[model samples]
Target: MCSNGWIRAHATYYGVNDSPASLGGACGYDNPYHAGFGAHTAALSGALFRNGESCGGCYQVRCDYWADPKWCLRGAAVTVTATNFCPSNNNGGWCNLPRHHFDMSMPAFFRIARRGNEGIVPVFYRRVGCKRRGGVRFTMRGQGNFNMVILSNVGGSGAVKAGAVRGSRGKTWRQMTRNWGANWQSSGDLRGQRLSFRVTLLDRKTMTFLNVVPSSWWFGQTFSGRGQFL
Candidate 1:
């Protein structure tokens, strides 16, 4: 890590300018546009992905103009959300293990580097708080006794550490386990009851979204909470 809190890393671009490829990613945010991340997103390397734990995290990245003036746009930077993973390649890839890399979307890359230099550019990145417009969202999935909640539009730390769910008929909250990426799963049958969710961030701050999901909610529907983390 750099003395200024920024860590030295490298960045590259993928997909076209704000294409569909940058939408649904490993983070389970089917459409980043509706998920509140927009097109400013990136696929993190293994070093930073932390086995999907780093999903929904935010980072501010800037090109190191001093290192490569030709490709790096002077004093240019962009903030992006972690939405996907860049798997390591055996053929000596930049996203290989032990190396921190950000495979940014083309639009996000153009904000910190000139066009045509889509390969790799030295950069400095630092974790930052995510600023979301609305409250946290939970997209309901699965059926019957199995329920998966995909958390999104989270603010503050932007990464969930733990989650719990409670039906209107029950006073106890069922602990949710990490299924994949930002998705948390609960095996309890919650059908025909209003749903409430409690989310805990890495900072240990917890928030309870009371009755965010109505009793009529379906598998493919999404519900928004009334509050957000600061």
Candidate 2:
């Protein structure tokens, strides 16, 4: 991290690999290689440092995720990182899951995930982890009840739709396109369908879009999705 003036660097310079097999003899220029390329980014980076192994000499501090009220309306872009909890099912991890594509004429929707319980009152925001029918239920914990909700299919047109919230008392409210919640689940069925959607704060007032689904994401066994913050 950097402040008015700050600096950082290598964990320990194992120095350089001088082994003959390591990009050696000035004849392997065509073949570029990195150690443990197969390991997770975190694991791979950590792999190189052993015994006195260090993650990154001058590392950065970070949070898994967070939300900012200022981000909601300050032209901040909301990004949704989708991760299917169960990979055996059709859902893929964030990087692999299909970006819910939709036609301009077709209505878009939101999928909030809340996997815990802590009596969370629903307001609207870039991300919400509410329960849903397409899959498992939403999770809640302290003020985080409504933290991970995300909007989908939002575009150049600034239009908003309000539909009755669906799901159990503590579940995500499914806002339909025409105030009709009945047809919510039975809508068009497409693995690659793109829907028109946008991210809004809990009040359903302040809103923005989480850019687009990322082509790739840092992963763990139980990663989550919805519009993400900076």
* Predicted model with the maximum TM-score: 1
RMSD of each candidate relative to the true structure: 1.7, 22.6
Give candidate 1's whole-model lDDT.
Answer: 0.90
- By lDDT, who's the top model here? 1
lDDT of 1 by residue, 1-230 (tens): 88789999999888775443376667778977888988899999999999888889899999999999999999888999999888897214888989999988888999999877747899999999999999999999987889999999999999899999999999999999999988899987899999999999988989999999999999989899999999
* TM-scores for all predictions: 0.96, 0.16
- Every candidate's lDDT: 0.90, 0.20
Cα lDDT tens digits, model 2, 1-230, are 23433222111001124322123111111111221111111111112122111111111211112332221122222122111111111112211223211100000011121223121111122222221212111111112122121122222111123322222222333443321100122122212222222333223443322212222221111112343321
